[model samples]
Target: MFRDTQSSWMSTLRHDVPASLVVFLIAVPLSLGIAMASGAPLAAGLIAAVVGGVVAGALGGSAVQVSGPAAGLSLVVVDLVHTYGWRATCMITLLAGAVQLLLGVFKAARAALAVSPAVIHGMLAAVGVIIALAQLHVVLGGSPQKSAVANVLELPGQIADLHGPKVAIGILTITVLAVWTRLPRVFRAVPAPLAALAAAAGTAWAFGWDVTRVDLSGSFTEWGFPVLPQGDWHLIVASVLLVALLAGCESLLCSVAVDGMHGGRRVDLDQELTGQGVANMVAGALGGLPVAGVIVRSTANVQAGARTRWAAILHGVWVLVFAVGFGWSITLIPLEALAALLVFIGVQMVNLGHIRKVHGHGEVPVYVVTMAAVILLGLAEGVLAGLALAVLLALRRLTWVTVRKRDDRDGRTRVTISGSLTFLGVPRLTHELRTIPYGAAVDLDLNIDFMDNGAFEAIHSWRLDHERMGGTVVIDELHDEWYALAASGARTLPAKSPLKAPDRWWLPWAQRRRGAEPVTVPPDGVSECLVTAGTREYHRSTAPLVKPIFTELARKQQPSHLFITCADSRIMPSLITASGPGDLFTVRNIGNLVPRRGSEPHDDSVVAAIEYATQVLGVRTITVCGHSGCGAMAGVLSGGVRAGSLPGLRRWLRHGNHSLATFIETEGDRLHAGALDVLCRVNVQQQLENLRTYRKVDEQVREGKLELVGLFFDIGSARVHLVPPLRPTLCVKPFDRPVVAGEE
Candidate 1:
């Protein structure tokens, strides 16, 4: 009895029409500019845009992503055209489309992400530099050289002999684009590219300047079919593959990025690849340039409220209608204006923000080297060089290890080795063990992941030599039992290693058996896992360092604030408050909740704790803190645990009923925005109000003898936000207190 439901047709038309118009307007100038930059006919750019929008939009996985000729692939197109001629380049594009289609059919689209981002961005940046260099000659009304170095060498001559009218138009276009973004919002509704084109074209006409313009007299009527490339068979195949992989990577990455913009549906990368391949094939057959997902139009589509693929298809229709009916107007746009647009775009591709972001991750060397190689050598060479460097960096990080040696309290030496253990670490292991006294007892802690036979034998031989001189050598494996397995004559271990948790505590509370012996730090040297490492650390360092602070705290604890919070291990009151020892008397429970007076069973524990904290401890302030992503708030919101499953726990959650009710009454309609986060804040405020139901707390508050506050801690951000209560608002607000020092 499954029935299909669909949204109203009116709703579809309402959203898609306006979004289509906006994307269409933005695509017109960019398509032409990219085409001009790639040395393809102006009609080829329009053809690609139309095919990308209609074909890809209808068949692609991403709903809002728009496709067109991309500036990122301009250099690739230019190189192919120069080597194979325009018609043969179209055949290469066709072959690339076939390759992409095969790749999509095989479901290998997601593998495209295996390439390093440093290499990708570097490749793009190099293309940017190349485009800017070549387009600079075009802007100056001079023919561009084959390579970037030649362009650089002849750039001074072009500048010296710059055509006055063309140079004026180019400068005016660049100037308009640079300043257009800073104009008033009302004046900027037109896309910057269109505005720059209009300004340059208008100036050329008004001043009677002789500037080159786009000529598309018989483009559609005289378009011819593509011919096969006459180059070496292997080179032709390689050229096809280069186009396919580059276009595929660009389109896939753009789709993934666009997916983050909406919550409607995730991009199906394989389907998107198939759609792009199909679009490229169609465009190639029509003598158009290679098509890919262009971020400019895609972003515009999303921002303009596109709800479905209809907007993308409609955009293509609009472009087709305009090109067929009003194609004459396009010829009026000055060539220098288009060159200036490409130059601006090319400069922007070498993004300072992107460079800074990758620089922080220590990938600047790869990015810089790739960019240099691309400008000096070529696109494929630069990417391969960057990928090689990135691989080396990854391998170095994976194989890194650290070894620490310290003398124990009882005249024995302890060695802690961590990370992967292989033959590479054998020399360091041998040198360190030999430094220990010949007759001294030794404690070896192997906190390693994997161990090769060479590392095992080095340690085994060292232990034997020490024991021959009457020295006791004890070895403990903190993680995997590498030594034990080796001793049992197993040369190779299982590929899947054991799960190792932090040894903050030796054993779980529920797992401890009766009569289990207490784990102690060895008198001679401590060599154990993380569970006992804290106790050992305390014995070795912390206890002595904090002796004075603890000695004073032991005498008296007169805390200024009585902090009540959830039992979540991450919510540490002292850590947040920057308190050393006993600055706050604390109470931890499931939800940081306070029940109404005489309302619930099993509420005595919380009531008594508050009573003792207030009446006995006489603390000045009482703070109830809640946190984001709280299990208790989420449980109450979602009913995650059944009352039958944990009756006792369910009874305790009844205290949160008022908080839930308050949230529904105040902000229920906006729950989809952030339900758990809003509930966490509301619960903190509700508990503060509940504290007033207690006569003692109310009396103290009224008499100016106490303060009540609510706090919210965001786990991911590590920020504490003050919650404003609605009822019986406190005289002293949470923000009234100065922020904790050094938190951020």
Candidate 2:
């Protein structure tokens, strides 16, 4: 068993490490030459190869992958160097590297893959052509050429004037190696390219081939080490940028591909990015060239049967040994061989079939990525462009809404919508409701809590449209949630959506204005699918049959007062006092606002909460409260409250109004304020006084038992506070006795 279990790991590792050695060997010469072509020191490209293996491998991503200076970058890096100078080019690289690191840290590594495939293919093909054109001089041993068919057209003239013996040696080397590479795999590792290098060097030695080699004597240390340029902040920055982007993109792509192949899911995209960012930072600091997750070596490892990320690490060992031990030998590899390798890599990326699949979904994504990748001349720009397009597409989808209609026993239409009602969806959703018919008794069922601020505002506008259509809209049922996004469903608007008023226009004005609830005659195909879904809250659950004081007060006449309180879902004034209709005028909100406090203009909600309660229902008592875990109390207790998050709520919470300034000062940081019980008492006391700001409310309270009182009801005990009576008048200890069903 030991032998068998160990056999698998040993056999796999042995094959993969050696195979990766071949891939790495292939990568080295290309790296050195590409760096030279890009107008950077040959060592810079070697740095990329070394860093690609060393840093990216140690960071632990993508098994069997390698990284190095890539030919794909030649045109862009070269042009940037020519235009901005090497130092500036390095700075750009540094900036690009930083961006890549950020993407990895943010787990945005996969964002690049979102590019439209057609655009990707088109860009890739364009890159292929660029690569082929740029390498023409080296392949044919001619001078530098420009891009396009024009340059290609002059190839005949260029070939006729080629560096005679160098051209001949290049031709002979290409031929013999081409034939040898075609031989069986075991023989292929005999290093035919190295043999060709020997043959070419021999020809140069035998015949005075005066073609220029790497012009090394211009700069070298006394110790014969290549002289690297002294660092400037600008150059270092550029190098960092280039390294970060190149590494991030290459690594993430390789990781994803490997994951797909083995089904060995290990890397978390975000964490992997974090790791890559750190890796690049280290690599850049050490003066290594930019490194990216290279796919070829990784794939070779996979082909050789790598089971772990370790294969990547091992490949780095081989690179270090070769770079240190064979520096002299490396200088002899022909520029043409490196170009051929790049051509091969470029060809592998054609992937036309993949493009067809991506094109099927839509073209916009492809369009965006294509333009970004090609136009911007760097992977970062293209990847970012692709990400932007994908996000826009997602937002559009969110805004594209669909609506469903359901009915309860009363035959009233419950319009349930599915999808985000974003501002984008507003015009469409608004128009759809116009067809609901006037005089329609529509219960706009916003059982969905999934609406963002934008969506909430959109639905709020619908209230105006509903009223304009001559229809009576009842915001009868709603969810208790406050910050409902489009994904969670919604709470119906009370007159003006969530947190408005119960009887906004008084029952009679609504009755006089539009009858018992206008009848809606569904326009075909709407009636049968009206299946009831979701639950209903009546705001009328009686245990000790605790009733609302408003209901008791409303029984006699239209009461114009609101009791803004906590969301306990109990402590009902209507049931506790047996008031009905317009008796005990009441308004309920988390925190009460009245008689504007602060430099801010008075909110309609404060005016409206009080106005509808006092002016509309003519409520005599305006009760404000803060109960256990009251979010508003927490705001005052914790210094520096964020009013923006809760919107209307933040404004209303200022009702602890004077408490934050006056009460807390006298009490000396002892915020009977943040504490639930203390907040409840403070809320009642503060609100009783604020209610006086409404002249009508003041007049009524002085007029008898209608007097405003402060109460602190303990939720644990289910006790009702009688305030000044200094007694828990409505205490129902569950342990003492089971609540007599429906007893008030």
Q: Number of the top candidate by TM-score?
A: 1
Model 2: number of backbone collisions: 68
Q: How many pairs in model 1 have backbone atoms within 3 A of each other, for residues 3 or more apart or on separate chains, i.e. clashes?
A: 2
Cα lDDT tens digits, model 1, 32-133, are 999998988899899988999999999888999999898888898988888888889888898898899999989999999888777878888888888888
Tell me, by lDDT, which candidate is best: 1
TM-score of 1: 0.70
- Model 2 C-alpha lDDT per residue in residues 577-603, reported as the tens digit of each score: 444554444555554434443325455
What shift in Å separates residue 663 of candidate 1 from its native position after superposition?
28
Q: Looking at model 2, which ten-residue stretch has the lowest summed lDDT?
A: 533-542
Error of 2 at 282 (Å): 6.6
Steric collisions counted per model: 2, 68
Model 1 residue 75 lDDT?
Answer: 90
lDDT of 2 at 451: 54
